[model samples]
Target: MIEAIEIPTAAGTFDALACGAPGGREVLLLHGFPQSALEWEFQLTALGGGGCHVVAPDQRGYSPGVRPEPVADYRIEELIGDVAAIADALGWQRFDLVGHDWGAYVGWAAAAAMPARIRTLTAVSLPHPAAFLRAMTEDEDQAQRSQYFTLLRKPRVAERVLLADSGAGLRKIFDWKIAEDRIDDYVRRLTEPEALTAALNWYRAMHLSGPTGPVSVPTLYVWSTEDTTVGSTAAMATERYVTGPYRFEMLEEVSHWIPEQAPEELTGHLMRHLLAHRT
Candidate 1:
């Protein structure tokens, strides 16, 4: 059975779900905006069955225990620090890292900021920040695609629009992409005013910061062609930001919800990436 646990951080106590046996290699799973650690349910089971312990956190502002008020509390540095605090709380010197969407953004930054604390990185959906920024500014397609972020940056209106009609607005965000049950979970979370604001703060706190420099750890980037939020330009440019061994896997016709819609394939890519570096 998966167990929910709390880890203390400089900010507050963060909630996480853990599964599998102790004393095994640890995999730190981080969930993205508008989602919780529940997003990693499939991966936790798969990795646990493979004799790897997994810890997936809801992250700050998302977890009720660690929700901070000010938008500045959700900056990249603080987000990355939360991941580090999770690792420290578990007494892990290093662990395999996997994250999706905004979680992937934090994972990318964390790995880059402290390469020694990460064994391997599996960044799902989102690419490195530098690549994304370049694509956002230079690629008109990306700029157009990201226009929704401008709306999300707005304070209370974005929250009301998302939570209106029992979160029908949030449901429309997923449309026909994510599964119904998963969409329900996302809507439920977004209904909470603080939760939705915290998630959006990740965007509001965006700055001119680049990727923490080229990552030295072995990494795997999973990009989906059908992802509405990311484009081919940024996806393909991810390789340029990694200084160490890297593998890029492209999922054809898959949406941003790859972890849920294609868990087996995602797990396969993650297993391959982690196992390849075992020896």
Candidate 2:
């Protein structure tokens, strides 16, 4: 069963969804921009049923109480700290970490920053930061795909542009991948000015420093061919940054919304990775 809960840490209070028994294996899932712990509902169900304790929090900016105004508060280190803080609050001495989209960027950093505390890592729809940064500089396709960053980094402009037209632009980003019913709620939440601004602050504060190093935890990296946000250059280059056991799964026709759009396959990979790496 999934339970809505709140976790209080030194940083702030976070709204979260948790599943499985208190003593079950630990797993922490992180959602990316414009999304919340809600994105991991499917994963929580499957993994919790499989005897793993999973918790997905409305990360730093998404959780209203945790939202801070300064862009510096949204830096990559703060993001990584949030992950550890959440885990610490959960009483999880060690846990399997899974992340999607921008969440994956944080996962990579967490794995590198606190290698001993992470048993395994699963990153979806994004590659390692070093690989992605390199691809952005040398790969035209990736550079083109990332051009949208220029706009998202703007303080108030992105909030205006994305929330415009009743979130038509934002809703369109989901395309036909996310369930129609789920789209409205997700879009509506982001339509709130403070929420949208906090979400975009992630892009504005991104410096990718800690994530640029080698990740030493057992890791699984999932990439979808149709993911417009990430490119083949970075996906293929991700292996170079992992010093521990690594597995890369390429979903042939999947889009960037892997958890919602490809839950079964994603669950399968996650289960195998988790079961194999149980410490």
Best by TM-score: 2
Off by over 4 Å in 1: 208-211
lDDT of the candidates, in the order given:
0.87, 0.90
Residue 236 local lDDT, model 1: 94
TM-score of each: 0.96, 0.98
Candidate 1 accuracy as lDDT: 0.87
Candidate 1 lDDT, tens digit per residue, 168-278? Answer: 877887756767888898778766758888888887877633445677799999999989989999999989999999999999988898898789999999998989987
Q: Distance from true position, residue 88, model 1, in Å?
A: 0.7
Worst 10 residues of 1 by lDDT: 207-216
